[model samples]
Target: MPGNLIHFRRRVRSVKNIQQITRAMKLVAASKLKRAQDRIIAARPYANRMLSVLNSMARRIDPAQHPLLAQRDRERVMLVVVTGDRGLCGSFNSNIIRSAMNFIEDEAANRTLSLTLVGRRGVEWFKTRPWQVRHEFVNIMTRVDHRYAREIGKGIIDYFSASELDAVYLVYNEFKSVVRQDVILEPLLPIRRLEFEQESDTDPGVDYIYEQPPREMLDFLLPRHVETQIFRAMLESEAAEHGARMTAMDAATRNAKEMIDQLTLTMNRIRQASITTEIIEIVSGADALEG
Candidate 1:
């Protein structure tokens, strides 16, 4: 009983140490999440305005005016997979990997699809797979910047212009809330399905006079729009990752506390039983001597 008590006491101590580490990790993740959320909030308005402007322009111009707006046979495609650089988040990286695999399995029957990995986890996982990887940007989740998005957008645009790829898509987690994230597989190329929203019931449409023709404006704005979209997606993914990590660490800390409590309780019970047995033995020995 004493040995068992000692063992459980040691277990309790170990769990307490783990609980402390998890608590620290949770706090760090929460801080990071706050900053990421702020960045996302700051970028949303500009991103929305960019989309609105593009929608208006796309409606006015012909698809023939811009290669990005042209519809081509979905022969060759690119899947840009965005994952976190690190793990410890619950099912965050695995869900993305699973979704990417599903996409490849479904699309392989018809089209020639390749991958553009964004995070270290995705890059490492896809390396073992048979699919071809066009590019990889690893370790960018810690410090996501617009320049990285611009570089990726430019490469994709150039590749599409060269007719290397027929279409492009992005797969990432969209941060919906602190505890929830939605996996998104969004189309990035050929710029299909343009929808613009009106302000009020009285407003039918708002028109603006452009300094250049619609075609020329599209030629300039189309690339920026793609970059902005990619940047936004990266920002969302970063925020989602932080949220997932924070939630996971919080759960882990709670679990550790529970384990510690159970262990301590077991230890106490064993100690008490040992003490009771010793007392009974001493009393019986005294009675035997008296007899």
Candidate 2:
């Protein structure tokens, strides 16, 4: 009985220690999540407005004038797969890698499918595969910046211009809320212009004068638009990663607490049984003495 009690006590102590680590991780993730969420929210307005203007300008121009706006037969493709640097985030990185691989497989027939892995997790996963890894940016999520986005955007632009890659896509986790994250697969290069279903009846279309030629303006704005999108994706992935870590740690902490409770109950039962045995033995001795 004493041995069993000691074992249960040790198990409970071990679980308590794990619970402390999990709780601390949860707190740290929560703090990072707040900062990441703020950046995403703050960036959305500017990006959206700029995208709207770019789309309007794109509709007014000729596709042949700009290589970025021109669409061609996609014989070669690239996937920019973004994932987290670390694990224990509860399938956050796995979902992204799986989605990207599925797309690559689906598009693999007769076409060249390449990868630009961004993050240590993604680089590790794709490196072992047979696909050609064109570029790798590890630990990029440690600090999300527009400079990195510019570099990535420039590489994509160059690849498309040189006809090295026909199309490019971005795959990452989009943050919906603290508990929910959605894996998003979106096209990045040979930029597509978005159109709305219904036009506003009360709005008079305003035409603005441009200092630069229309084609020159579009040429500059198109790259900036791509860089903006890359930056936004980085922000979304950061928030989603932190949210996933926070959720995983919370679940682990709860499980640890439950295990500790069960161990404590078991220890109490064993101690009670040992006391009962002692009481029964004492009573037996007294009766024998009286007899």
Candidate 3:
């Protein structure tokens, strides 16, 4: 009984230590999440405006002239898989890896699809797979910025221009809220123009004076638009990563507390039972002496 009590106390102390670590991690993640959320929110307006401008320009320009806008028979496909660098987040990395694998399996039947992994988690998960990995970028989540996005965007653009890959796709977590992040598998290449629904109250036609030819504007705008999309995805994934870590740490801390409570309760029960037994033994000895 004493041994069990000692073990329980030790376990309680271990759990308390774990609880403190998890609480600290939770607080750190929360702080980072706030900054990430602010950045993503601020970037949204610029990204949306860029897309709108791209759509307007794409409608006027011929697809044949622009390499990005041209449609091609997808002989080869590239999947840019985004995940977190570290673990301990509930299912954040697993969910993305699973989704990407499913997609790769599906696409393997028809197209020769390759992977471009971002973050150590995805890289480690897919490194053993049979699929060809064109690029693997690890430790990228720690410092995500427009320059990183631009570099990735430029590489894909160059690949497309060189006719190495016919199509490109992006798979990442899209942050909806602090608690909700949905896996997004979206096509990123051949630059499809999104059609907007005309509002009844809006003007029939709106015109803008162009400083340059629409084709020239599109030549410049299209690449930047792709970069913007990549940048936005990076931001969303960063925020989602922080949110997931925060939630996971919070849950871990709570579980540790619960374990400590249960252990303490068990220790108390054992101690009480030992005391009662000792008292009974002492009373029996006294009675035996009297006899």
Candidate 4:
């Protein structure tokens, strides 16, 4: 029993150490989640405005007038997948990867499709797959900015402009709230203007003059718009990852605490049993001496 008690003490100590690490991780995740969430929220207004502006411009421009707006029969397609670089964030990475696999499986007949991975996890996940990887960007979730997004956007635009790809799609996790995120797939290129008709309906009653020709403005703005959207998606995914990690770690910490409590109770009971046994043995020996 003493040996059993000693072994249990060792186990309890190890679990307590793990509990401490998980608690620290939970706190760290919470701090990072707050910052990431704030950045995502702050970026939304600018991103929405940019989308509105692009939508307005796209509405006025003819498809034949701008290369970016031109729709083609998709002979070659590109899937840009965005995910976190690390794991331990519950089902966040798994959900995105699973969705990507489903997408690939659904489009398996279309063998001309290429993949563009935006995070280390995405890159690593698809590395063993038979799909063709056209582009990859890693460490993007660490600090996503417009410049990085624009670089990626420019690559997509250049590829499409050069007729390397017919259509482009982006898969990412959209942050709905701290507790909720949805995996979303958005068509990025062949700049679908018809989809923006609902957005046009909500526009304020105002007209603006274009400095350059509308077509010329679109030529410049469309690529930047794509970059901004990609950056925003990265930001949203980062925030969602942090939120998921925080929640998971918090739960793990709580479970560890509960387990420790149960184990402690068991240890106390065992100690009490040992003390009672010792007392009973001593009393019996004394009685035997008296007899």
The residue pairs found clashing in candidate 3 are none
lDDT of 4 at 80: 91
Give the per-residue Cα lDDT of candidate 1 at 159: 86
Among all windows of 10 consecutive residues in model 3, the one with the lowest summed lDDT is 199-208
In model 4, where do residues sit more than 4 Å from their true spots? Answer: 195-210
lDDT of all the models against the reference? 0.89, 0.88, 0.87, 0.85
Runs of candidate 3 exceeding 4 Å displacement: 194-210, 213-216
Tell me how far the alpha carbon of residue 290 in candidate 1 is from the true structure, in angstroms, after superposition: 1.8
- For candidate 4, write residues 180-243 as lDDT tens digits: 8899998899877744434455664343576888667777788778988998998999899888
Between 2 and 4, whose TM-score is larger?
2
RMSD of 2: 2.5
Model 1: colliding residue pairs: none
Please give each candidate's TM-score: 0.91, 0.90, 0.93, 0.90
lDDT of 2: 0.88
Task: Please provide, for model 1 over 126-214, each residue's C-alpha lDDT reduced to its tens digit, 9 standing for 90 to 100.
Answer: 99989989999998889999999999899899988888999999999999998998999988897875554645677434455679886
**RMSD, candidate 4, Å:** 3.0
At residue 280, candidate 1 shows an lDDT of: 100
Candidate 2 per-residue lDDT, tens place, 1-291, comes to 798889899999999999999999999999999999999999989888977777776555567777888788989999999899988889899999889988988999789998888889998988778999888898889789999999988988888978788899999999999999999999888777555445668633444477988678777888899999889998999999999999999999999999998999989999999999999999999999999
Q: Which ten contiguous residues of candidate 2 have the minimum total lDDT? A: 199-208
Candidate 4, residue 174: how far the Cα is off, in Å: 1.6
Give the clash count for model 1.
0
